[model samples]
Target: MATTAEYNLGDFTYPRGWFMIGLSSDATQTPLAVRFFGEDLVLYRGASGKPHLVGAYCPHMGTHLAKNTTSYVVKDGEHVQGDSIRCPYHGWRFGPDGQCDDIPYSPKAPPKRACISTKKLVERAGCLWFWYDEEGGEPDYDLPEFEGYDEPAWVNWNVRCLGELDSHPQEVIDNICDKGHLEPVHGSLNMELFENEFEGHVARQILSAGHKTLAADGGEPMTNDTWYTGPGILQSKMIGEFPSLMLIAHTPIEDGKVKVWYGLSVKVQNTEPTEEDRALAAGYEEAGVDAFAQDFEIWANKRPCLNPMMVEGDGPFDKVRIWYRQFFNPRARAGEFQKRVNGRYVVRGTNTHPWDNAA
Candidate 1:
């Protein structure tokens, strides 16, 4: 497991960004208790079908909001009222803004001081993402959304929560610039072209992986355009006969461990998902999971690469590390770090991959 000292990220303990807290399906009218960034949070859906996230504990009586079942107002068998959530302990109702709106037993209006802190959240691309900042500010940027997420021709998997792993996210982020590890780590070979572009909080990597698995055919190299939005979300578009969108999100649960999630949406050939589409989607997802598992195995077993011994053909590990440092520091430090790492790249090479832009 890589410690913060081992990784040497920066002053901040956790990076600020819009990280996937859980799947959209994980939340309903009832609040679901979740923990991220080493803090407990409550996630629930409103009557308007919108998701809400707030500090887990109610300000009054110091009770966890999700555990308050004694005085819950249930309509349609759901514990939520409009966009408001009631504290089970004292029946104090908190609105979507985290301000106390009402007190069941009080004639006077709820005091302004009797409010709970709310976390910013956004629901997009079939996932629930929450904004986290060291100073409690708004989200720095928006999360990237895929094109055909909820369409009929796509088969969406329920979020595969992989529990917790003892590893820091920087170790996972390092994979973006690791061209040399592709063949060994994921069995992806024939890397005719591998390039990384860092623009602001996003890092893009284009890989021409010679067919090992997850390719539509057994012979053609797969051109994959993968990118990280902020510090947590990694989205990849695997171009093949049956193209797929890969969504991988990991958030720190502790100093050296993270809760990981895997999800994929497969584009079906037919207008509606048929049995054949389902089978193909299943196969594609299985292959992707297998490939990721290989990476996990290394992460779980290898010693921390805080200051890796870089050699030839290691790709831009140092450059990616510089880009990643922005998240671990305050705005002042991040700004300076960004100036050094933010830039564009057009890595070109010889390749017969169908999706290759360069000839």
Candidate 2:
């Protein structure tokens, strides 16, 4: 497990971005105890059914906020009230903002200092997202709309929560510019085009290729437009028999360990998906997950690549790393890193576009 400093990414140990913390189902009246960004955190829904993410320890006595079961506060169904959660140990209640709303045994008002730290969260596309910033600032980028999640002509994805990997997210991120891995690892047969674009706060890959596992034989090559919004979330639009959208979100559990999720929303050949259409979309999603697992397995077993011994046809790995450093550094200095890599780079011999114009 190599630390972020080992990579010399930036001053912050964790990057600033909107990170997926857990599945939407994980947030319920019964608070969930989970860890992220090296902090033990609690996630639960209020009476209004909105989810909240807050530090797990009660500020007053350091009791685990959501870890007890026998406490009457929990057994009496008083654990969660409205949009607030009570400590299972002492019944000290905290609001969604993490301020101590009430201390069951206290006569005087709760101290102004009595509050747990809270993480800003949003529920979307069947997952909970948290904005993480070392500077304690609000989100600097927007989370992807994950379009077609619940719209017609598309099958809503039940995001596959693939769980945690004991590896740094840097490894997972390197995939976007890793054209070399396509042919060997992902069965990307004869790659026709491979190029990357590094715009401010967005890193994109445009690929036109064939795949042994995810494509049909003797068909048009798979065309994919993939990108990362900030650093934690990635989306890919794959044009195929049924156009599909792929999502991969990874966030730090600790400095060197991270959690990951993968999902696919498939557009069906109907205005409203029927049972048959649903079944077919599910099969496509499953196949997409299978394709993703190929990369997941490698990240699980491989050692961290702090520095890649770059070679030709590698699809600009060095540039990708430089672009990723923006997230790890101070937001004020983000442009410094982005300016160094923000441009289109077409690998030689791809031959998918004219040499002068990428379009």
| Candidate topping TM-score | 2
- Give the deviation of candidate 2 from the true structure as CA RMSD: 2.0
Model 2 bad stretches (over 4 Å): 351-359
Q: CA lDDT, every prediction?
A: 0.80, 0.88
Off by over 4 Å in 1: 68-79, 213-219, 344-359
lDDT of 2 by residue, 25-125 (tens): 99999999999999999989999989999998998789998898999999999999999999988789999888998988989999989999988999998
lDDT of predicted model 2: 0.88
Per-residue lDDT tens digits of candidate 1, residues 182-298? 876777756677878898888999888676664446446888999998899898998877788988899988778899988778998888999888888988888788788888888
Candidate 1 clashes between residue pairs 3 or more apart in a chain or in different chains: 68-88
TM-score per candidate, in order?
0.88, 0.96
Output the worst ten-in-a-row residue range by lDDT, candidate 2.
349-358
Give per-candidate clash totals: 1, 0
